[model samples]
Target: MPTLVLLRHGRSTANTSGVLAGWSPGVDLDDHGRKQASAVAERLRPVPLAAIVTSPLDRCQQTLAPVWADRDLPPVVDERFGECRYGDWTGRKINDLVKEPLWKVVQQHPSAAVFPGPEGEGLAATQARAVAAVREWDARVLESHGKDAVWLACSHGDVIKAILADAYGMHLDLFQRIVVDPCSVSIVRYSETRPFVVRVNDIGGDLTGLLPPPKSAGNKDEVDASDAVVGGGAGTV
Candidate 1:
């Protein structure tokens, strides 16, 4: 088993402008986003990450840039971690999209929601693929590394929310109720039986405890209670 850290990319121009930058190219982290990325990097600096997986998007890659800049490990780009394909709504503003008839379904019943375009992707399908990708990565990391291995996945808000929903065993319709903010960190430790959700939507806090103590040192069996800190937040899509 391994600890998977889900990190959403920092605030982007689209987030500030209230636009839906779904799978849209050229979307990058804003100035404030750069600072947030730096903060997240520093927060996890002490943790020994086995690998870093990132969505194949500019914003995600840009957000991960600072973290990987000083490390020898490069990111593994996975398209499954990319943003929900909004189809015709790809570059549209969220304000205008809210007026659409399917907006209610998107917010209230995302499992039934479908992007209105020929190439659009369904919310359920998005959740399945994203969850599968995370599970695959988790298994691969554990097999290659060890039970206490730690890794990071940089993705979009919706994608991270979908993965969180799967980890919580929640139905897809209830996924919209999970809010993953910009540059937030959510931790999940997979075990032989089930996954333990250590933290969710953690923006800023003491993360030193998340680092695994030296294996070659004494008291390797001792568990840090602070590592299991739990908190909650209101949900938003």
Candidate 2:
């Protein structure tokens, strides 16, 4: 099968504002994220991608615009790779959510974690859909582009982590341990026996987001929860 390059969308407005922004509409990439998106073109210049896949979300779409704009291959927008259906959690701040009991389940036993609200779905379901999408795309790409072909997919952090978990045969409960920073690249290649995770959360292209975050003016203690170092964080620097 073709090797897959998983790219998480650049930092977004929600990221800077300390919001989860899961499947939230009108959440576009922030200024710093725009620059990171542009740099992605230059960073991947050396790799010849046979196909481009993306989640049907604005942030992911915008993150990939620069790269596909200059290329002949149009991106395959797949909803399966979209952000986790946070439902009531959508648009909520991470700091506030951390105080909820569900937070513990999400961190420790994500396989059993299900977001509250009408639109919510369990983390296990999210992994199943995302993994299915990637495998289907991999086979399609391999058949059309050949076994040595390389492809790219732009998606949400959690969605990418779930896919990587499947690739490594890791349990969904442990997916939280994988950190996929904004604009980072994680590569995986599938063979007859097993999938090879070539890279995981490989940060590159933009350095500005890696510098220490600026102190928030509002509350002296107020810091963007997205900037936390756990699992690569939200890159709010």
Candidate 3:
């Protein structure tokens, strides 16, 4: 069995502005996001991760930088984990697009929703692609390092949510319920059996019981969940 840790990138300016920044170049993490990433890295230091993977997107890469550097591990960038191709909606205000009739379909039925306009990739398409990518990563890591290997993936909220829903038995509708806060980490263990979530929406990195003791030698049990918030988005990628 391998334990997979999915890390959502820290908050970006696009997130605060309510814009669809799919593949947009300027969607980097803000100062607060950088601090959050550092906190998460400190909390995750105890986990015996065999590899750290990330979407090639700048935000994802930035979020993983501190943790990756601390562990002296380089992140394996995978294009498959990149965000949904919003096409024409890229760099547009989320509120503006939701007002459109066609975009409403996504709000009501994300599993079947398709992006309108040129070269857009649908929810179903992203689901299929990301799932395959995760499976491939799991297979390769497990084959090379065996079941005890722990893997971390730095990705977007929707991407992590969708992958978790597919791998575990979580309802697609409850996708909105899983709060992936900026710099938050979710852990899942996978074997011949289905995956099980060890923790969800954990912020400030309290991995006490879940992680083996680290050389830093500090022990703590209390974790504050105040940083998490309800999903305001009508639909996810």
Candidate 4:
């Protein structure tokens, strides 16, 4: 299947304010975040993405603005990729939430955590929908663009973390240990057998590695992109 590049949106005004800002409307990227967004364009210049998907929230859209500029790939907005519905916790300060008893449950056992109020979504539910979204997209991209195709999806921290957990087969309770920083990029490639997590929570690194290697004169000698290289054999050419 095609390679999947997971990007967490850049820092937002809520981040500086120490607020949760879940599903908040006006949370655009802060100055530092805008810079990070611009840098993403340069880092990804050498790679050609088959598709770009994004959460409908403003911050995730803003984070991809530079990457989409002067390009034909307008981002496809997917609601399932949106931030976890925090319900009453939306726009609340993180400092205050940490003091709440539920915060410990969220950190120590997210699988058992459920936000308060009718609008609130359970952590387990978030994981289910998000994992399904990526898996669906991966299949679509692979069929439309071929095995070597690379793709990008810009989303929130928790959403990306949940997707990564599914790829790694890790329980939701252990997901808190994974840190997806602002504007960071993670990679995953799905094969017929299983999903391979190539990288995770990468803030900055060489992205040329994302590009598929050149094809040989004959297809007979081609190696399967989905196959893991034993002894971490020579990386992408």
- Go through the candidates in order and give each one's C-alpha lDDT: 0.88, 0.85, 0.78, 0.90
Q: How close is candidate 3 to the true structure, as a TM-score?
A: 0.84
Worst 10 residues of 4 by lDDT: 221-230
Model 2 clashing-pair count: 1
- Sort the predicted structures by lDDT, highest score first: 4, 1, 2, 3
What tens-digit string does per-residue lDDT give for candidate 3 at 1-237?
Answer: 667888899999899889888999978999989988888888888767888889999999999889888677799999888988888888999889878776756655777777767968887788788879888888888898777678888888878888877766865655655677778888876666566566676776356555432334454643222222246323211
Let me know the TM-score candidate 1 reaches against the reference structure: 0.90
Estimate the TM-score of every prediction. 0.90, 0.85, 0.84, 0.95
List the candidate 1 regions with Cα displacement exceeding 4 Å. 213-237
After TM-score superposition, what is the CA distance of residue 87 in candidate 4 from its true location, in Å? 1.1
Model 2 error, position 90 (Å): 0.5
Total clashing pairs for each candidate: 0, 1, 0, 0
Query: How many steric clashes does model 4 contain?
Result: 0
Q: Can you write out model 2's per-residue Cα lDDT over 99-205, one digit (the tens) per residue?
A: 99999999999999999999998999999999999889989987998776788999999989999999889999899899999988898878766787767888764
Model 4, residue 4: displacement in angstroms? 0.7
> lDDT of candidate 2?
0.85
Instruction: Give the C-alpha miss distance for residue 36 in model 2, angstroms.
Output: 0.9
